[model samples]
Target: MAFSADELRVLRRALAVALHPAPLHDEDVQDALLLAASVDEAVREAGRLRAFLLADLARYREALPGSLSGYLELLRDALAAGYDPQADDLAALRALRRNPAASELLARCRILAERSVRARLARVSQATATSAPTGPRARLFALPGGRAADDEPKPNPPAPAERPVPKPSEVFPPRRRPVPPPPPEERAAG
Candidate 1:
């Protein structure tokens, strides 16, 4: 959101007062409160506008071929306004792919959808990385007779004795002896 020069001045003064903890003039306090309220109102208005656009887009999509042009136009506007394409939008565009405009929009929407998915994955991975436990975890189950599994130091298993590995010929012998070829086809005769 672009802040007007007057709003910027008010915001600067408010930040300075906040950081410095100085007594502010009544006028400055009122200006800061008004600016904050305006910002909140602007946010609410944008949300309402986005909701209306989505509802209109849905209506246009439902009207199908008859509203193809309007739907495409609204969809383009929605995309430009940072709306992520929904499954319904993708499906509708796929069904109307015969139209060049719909085809182009479909490609654009697919790219946007992929980007949205990647961004969500990145966010999820970031959250998981940040929130995952870094220390040793407690055991879920205990041994019988009130003994915890990790209470005692267990002895390591004994290693097997070293042995020679058998060659393939020793493991899998030939099933039968090789038969000699006929002596030169019986000197080229049957």
Candidate 2:
């Protein structure tokens, strides 16, 4: 989308006018309009190109092993054009992983697929986090007794039972008494 020198000049003038609040001349206005139209056309052309590439990629994928080389080439081009690899594309690449090119493409496609999954999950999580109720929700109907759910007294969880403390003797057995002087007598005799 390289702009012509004349279009660049017009763009710069338009920016200046936007910043400075000056009235655009008839020629400047016409140039700006023309540049805008050119940009729109370029965007449309890019979309069409993307659509064509995707269609070509699908055809190549359908052809399978017979079109391995062409499929790989088309897949590369599609990836370069920011195509999000679909499950079918990943499965096809996986099937052709015997090919070095297919293996490389499968790795790249896996990364793209993971990123897409993560992005979708992030969006869903973000939406749920934002839209989910944060406070106590109001009950639509009363309980069996016509009492609001919130108005009922909440039951408290049971307290844990206390265990009896073990005596010191139970925790640690008493040490045996030392041998009497008989040991010393025996040593002296020896």
Model 1 alpha-carbon miss at residue 101, Å: 0.9
Name the lDDT of candidate 2.
0.91
TM-score of each candidate?
Answer: 0.71, 0.68
lDDT digits (tens) for residues 20-95 of candidate 2: 9987789999999999999999999999998899999999999999999999999998888788999999999989
Query: In model 1, how large is the Cα lDDT of residue 82?
Result: 100
lDDT of each: 0.94, 0.91
Weakest lDDT window of 10 consecutive positions for candidate 2: 141-150
Worst 10 residues of 1 by lDDT: 141-150
Best-fitting candidate, measured by TM-score? 1
